[model samples]
Target: MLCLYNFIRTTGTLKKQPVYVWMWFTGFIFFLITYLESYLWLIPYFRNNIVNDLTIQWKSYGSMVGSWNMLIYGCGIYLMDKISGTQTYSYSKTGFAIYFLGLFNLMFNWGHHIYTVPTHGYIKHVSYLVSMTELLLLGRIIFLWRRQMKQNKKHIHQPGFRFYAAADFWIFLTLVLAIAMSIPAINVYTHGTHITVAHTMGATIGINTFLLLAVVFDQLNPLIRKIKNFHRYLLPGFRICNISLFIFWISLIVAGIMKAWWQVHRPEVPFSTMMISLRPYFMMFMITGVTLTAGMWMMLLPVVKQYFMHGMHAKKRMELLYKKRNASLSTY
Candidate 1:
């Protein structure tokens, strides 16, 4: 209780972007459904019920959350639309690609939930393909983004702590992402479990961290510039978290991949058996990351917004984006 009170106090006002509000609402809905399925749903359904009912319930909730997650995909489209309508400082094609790919990865993650559910047959197979498609989409997005950036040979090339910090994150995200995807290929030959878990952590959960890191670093530019020798002072912390993000992304991707493959190959194994296998890794990539990452985000965004939203620079940018764009439209 005290902790919650302190959290709320220190966190201060969390500015609710339209997208952020929708995410909270959807997240709460998903949590409620998860709680019911994991706890309350069992008792009522098990009243002279069989495993079939459980599978049905699982599918139902999976569908529910999956739908909510899909709505987030719609939010990505919203982001896309906003970016397109503006001419000033739009996401580079590369940024747009990464943004879209993030959406693709999330879609499959939802599919993965349904795939593991029992009695989920043809539907599961379809979901698997879609999920795999998500992976391919993500891989392509990253690949293309980098390649196009190289071809275009354009960047602001600014010298600042935030610049270096952002560079560190992207570098880490790229390197770990490569290793994460390769773990499955390596496992096919050597069949090592240790590497496999590391892969999942990197891919799924780590990607989440990287995404958040990118958002934070991008938004932190104003704050970063305000500090003295911000780059030098920030490097140690940036390196530490970037490394953590890299590893976590590695662990998550590997974990999600290995778990999926193991389930497909060994359906007879109790689901709990496989899930238990993941619990330890999940502790690092899932629980701990979620706690710190979400808390930090919910806490820090307020401060960042204060910094980001202030001054003539922001007003100029907003005027360029919304006002100028709208004014031009009127002239047209």
Candidate 2:
């Protein structure tokens, strides 16, 4: 559907677009097929088969996740192009390099997730190496992006740009944690630990979700600017939502670390005892979740209402105009 929309809006074939477009288009196609296979075949196959080894299951699941990342990364490309006001930005060699690296990770880097499975040692090591490369590539991308943003500081703090920047920060932080966890020596301790949970949480909440939201707010920014006092609400809402999310995110990391430490270093400790120890972090997560939710509701509620009302009223006006035109035509 996305590709179809792009084709409809474009002057020519999708092949005429930049390299990143092809990368994402292929990913989108695969994502649809993967989703179908997962629902129609994979789940039932797993259920009926009494498979002892979970290596295939876990590894495939990880790659499936990587598959969806294509959509997110594609959105990131679109958002970046929109923000920078450049059509060819995604075709730059640097951008092409990142896209291929992302494609590599999508297909292969998922091996790290199965390090704990009874897989070959070399497989795990190779995955670790491939996983590390993502961090370097992402870091370079962000460094160059930030340098550009610095040169154009006037637009840096715009609501959409702010969300993009926040996503970059989250990407950096998640990559660091992921790199640390990818070390086989460290994975021995962190696998199946809260630390692993932290990595997933950061990637989902910090990077993908943030970037998607940035795109949403960005597309809405023009409409918002036309309304009086919208920025007054939106600016503060952005701050509150981001602040609460950071707290929510960090709290998970803290909880994950504590859980991993007690599980490994104090194996004699009861799980209940560990849960009791982790109660504060859980409480913090709950509080921040509420704050984040409330802040988002407050921020988006008015905008959503206005959007719907405008659409409906516009439709009615068009309908009335069409009726009047028909009546005049009948009289003529």
Candidate 3:
């Protein structure tokens, strides 16, 4: 449907937005393939041959994840250009570099996810190398952004900017965690632990969620301006959410490390005992989850109300304007 729409509505415009359209199209193909394979072949096959087929399914799952990343990373590229307010970002060499590198990672880094699967040593090594290359681009972006932020202190307050900023911070922090986790030695202990959970959460919530929110808030900027003192309501929730998120993120990491250590060092310990030991971290997770939920509700409620109000006003204005236009046309 989207492809057909793009073909009809965006036939002449693809050149102007090459990277955007390409990523969207490629992601769509990947999603279709992944979905079909999972439903038609992978699941039933796994059920039939539960023992010998696990490794292949693990690899397949990685590629399945890789497929959707095209969509998410495409969003990241689009958001970067949007936030920077420059047409050049997506067109530049740096942009192409980031895009292709991301593509490469999407295709091959699935190996890293299955590092503990007793695969060839080379598979793990190659995936580690590809994964490390990502940090290079990430570092350059952070450096450039820090330099820009130092020069202009005003955009920091914009909700969109703040969200993007949070995403950048997450990229840095998550990259560090990911790099450490990618090591074969580290993967030995942390492979199935909450640390892996932390990595997944960091990527989904920290990076992708922030980027999407930044785009959403940016799109809503006009609506926000029409509302009186909207910032006063938004800023507190934003701060609370991010601060709690940071604390929440750290707690997960600490919990993961503790769990990994206990499982390895004290294999004799009962599963119940381990759960008891991890109760404090779980409690922290619950508290932070409540905070996150409250913060999001607080932030989104006014935005939703204002959006509907503005939409109604816009509809009425457009109707009146059309009526006036028709009257003027009749006079002519």
Candidate 4:
């Protein structure tokens, strides 16, 4: 709300603002609506019935997630424009079309999530199409942005740029998985399994976390510059994190596939026996998860400590200034 208010106040009118601003405004509006819609299950009138159940589920899974993804995409685009030193709005038609498509997807993309629900056939078809298109558009935007980056600017915030690159890779990988799962026949096997978990983890940690990290590193460029051999320290953790994440992701997908296969073809098998058979994958998943956490902490701790020291020095300077000001006032 504060962001929306400030944006409107600063821009005066929405017409002149860039595409990202519009995307953010749309995100904020729909996020509020969908977030509120998620709570409708609490009301007696909205509970138990198939219509309300589907509404709540779709709002929770689709628009709620889509809303935040829109916000993040806006931020990601703005970051790319800043880094590449290009006027994204110069390509206004493309930008606006992306915004429109995102909006359409936000509204209708929940269908794939609720595939198991006996909703209208059109809903699933529309969602599957829109979701694929949305992913492709996002991937294309990032690809073009990366291609357009000047060699000189590439070195400006190298660490941050690397994170953005990682996000692009993850977006492509996740898109492939998303496309496969969106197919009705494929979704029957993948939905409600570890594959769904893999999808969630990829989006949350891979895309969202990497994008946010880019912003963080970009903001801390001054401090980063002060540290000698920063990349040397960072590289190990970076490699470990990405490699572990990939392994972890793959393990989940394999586990999901095995579970799905057994459930369909070996229904006579006991759940315990199936779980026992899946032990190795689950063990790998847990180990990789731990390593991923360790890798992130290794990268984050030094940056956090630097920020803390900077804050303390800033506080001391302010204290000294206050003391000098009091002394001057006394003399006067």
Candidate 5:
């Protein structure tokens, strides 16, 4: 938030970076829907309803948010055409591969969100099928990307950042998350506790946490800091966030295990409440209020902004300031 304010204070054309614009638009929609769901779920109105009712509402609003997000996100990625050879796309083939993968991913999400509607049974089945299929395709995309990165024996970069080593981490996490999410019959095989919560946390930590860490590592490269000659202070910022996410994931994992083990607890209460009622040692801070939320937000805050705004706003402002100074000097 502070960074955004400072960025806006300076002056420059933000340009027609459609990818940046779409990313921010998607993120803005994400924030709004998340905010609404968080508040709405807490209210008593939807509490007593069947899972289907809650699911329906979620799907309705989620579809609205996601459809527009897809359009903008696709536009942004397409706009990357100008940055083909640069760090933005790495190479033409690599960039197209990524763009297609992203396009398909959005379509899959759209299908999945609409699948379970009460009006259509066949639509639901098709949606379910595509969801898992997209997961496998996503896994393959990561694999190909990693292969390309290795075969090239080189990496891409931008000013103030040049660490492609983190791409490996990104690919690995995406695979892990895809596998975890694609598990069929998970709900039926589960002994107790809702299958959804565990799946949600697993994806959140497995994918979200790793992606955040990858960005931080790409920026800081602490593992090879001695040889890299980068600023040492940035290491602490990345480290703090990485450790925070690790702890959060570990805590969520432990809580899930306990929930599965203690089958007698009622599902009416929130997961946080149930985890606290378990009274497990690890569950103390991990399952409670603020900790998980703060950790997840910490990871997301930077990645979300970086993707959407890309710190490029600050750069744009700096360029404008430089141009203004040059113009003033010319007056003499």
Candidate 6:
């Protein structure tokens, strides 16, 4: 609510703000609605009905998740514009159309999550179409954005720019997985498997995490520069995290494929047996997860420590000034 209020105050009116601003505002509004909708299952009136069951399934699966994606994507667009020194408030008509379509997609895309559930055929078809359209539109936007960048201004904030680039790569990778999973035929096998987990993790860690780190590094640019030998950690950490994440992602996909194959061809096999078969992939991803964690801490720890140290120094200065003022008053 406070965020919405501040956003509205800053933008003043939606008509004047850029397309990304609208995306962010819509995200904030819809996120609240979907979050509340998630809890509707707790209400007696909404419980024990086909409609409510479908609603819960959809909400649990993707609607709220999509809302937050909107917020992150919006921020990403804004950052891209800022970093490239292309703060053009003007948007093409196609951009506006895509934005509106994205709003519609966010509302209806939840249907894909309910495919296994008994529901209208139109719901599934519409969702599949909408999801594809959104991905294509996003790809187009990224293509255009990349083309618009005339020169690398990355020297201004190298870490931030590199993280943003990493996010773009991950977006492409995750979109491939997302598009594949959206296919009803493919979804049948992958829906509840680790493929779904892979898709979510790719989006969360690959795209969202990198984009957020870009923002964080941009904000901490000065502090980062002040820290001695920061590059030692940053360079290795960045490489390690990306490499580990790629391995982790592939491991999940391999496990999901194996699991799905077993389920389809060897339905008579017990769940424990199938899991035993997946143990190698599980071990591979687990080790990579640890490496990923270590990489993140290496990159983040120095900046965080510097930030708190600066804060403490500022507090001490204020305290000394206060004490001096008190002594001056006493002299008078």
| Residues 19-107 of candidate 5: C-alpha lDDT, one tens digit per residue | 44434444444445544654555566666665545564555454454444444334333333322344355234555454455444443
How high is the CA lDDT of each candidate model?
Answer: 0.48, 0.75, 0.76, 0.83, 0.46, 0.83
List where candidate 2 sits over 4 angstroms from the true fold.
1-16, 36-53, 145-152, 329-332
Per-residue alpha-carbon lDDT of candidate 6 for residues 157-230, written as tens digits (9 for 90 to 100):
47688788788778888878877888889988897899989998999999999999998898888888889998
After superposing candidate 3, which stretches have Cα over 4 Å from the reference?
A: 1-18, 40-52, 151-154, 311-332
Candidate 2 lDDT at 32 equals 60
| TM-scores for every predicted model | 0.44, 0.87, 0.85, 0.91, 0.48, 0.92
- RMSD values for the candidates in order, in angstroms, are 13.4, 3.1, 3.6, 2.5, 9.8, 2.3
> Regarding lDDT, does 4 or 5 come out ahead?
4
Residue-level lDDT of model 1, residues 47-158, one tens digit each, is 4465555555555555454444434333433433332354322234644454445344433333333333355466555545544544555455466676545533433222
Give residue 154's lDDT in candidate 3 (0 to 100).
56
Angstrom error at residue 3, model 1: 22
> Candidate 6: what lDDT?
0.83
Looking at model 2, residue 278 earns an lDDT score of 91
lDDT of 2 by residue, 1-332 (tens): 77646744662567557765766666766666645544433465555653323655555667677767777777877888877778776778777777788777876687777776766777777787898897776568566886856844866655677667777778778888888887878877777766777688778877887788788878888666666777677778777887888888788888888877887799999999999999999999899989888877767887788788779999999999999999999997
Which is superior by lDDT, 3 or 4?
4
Q: Which stretches of candidate 5 lie over 4 Å from their true place?
A: 1-55, 61-120, 136-138, 145-171, 188-230, 261-332
Model 6 regions lying over 4 Å from their true place: 89-98, 138-157
How accurate locally is residue 118 in candidate 2, as Cα lDDT from 0 to 100?
67
Off by over 4 Å in 1: 1-43, 46-120, 147-200, 203-205, 244-332
Candidate 1 matches the true fold with a TM-score of 0.44
Steric clash pairs (candidate 4): none
Candidate 2 residue pairs in backbone clash: none
Which stretches of candidate 4 lie above 4 Å from their native place?
89-91, 138-153
Order of candidate numbers by lDDT, starting with the best? 6, 4, 3, 2, 1, 5
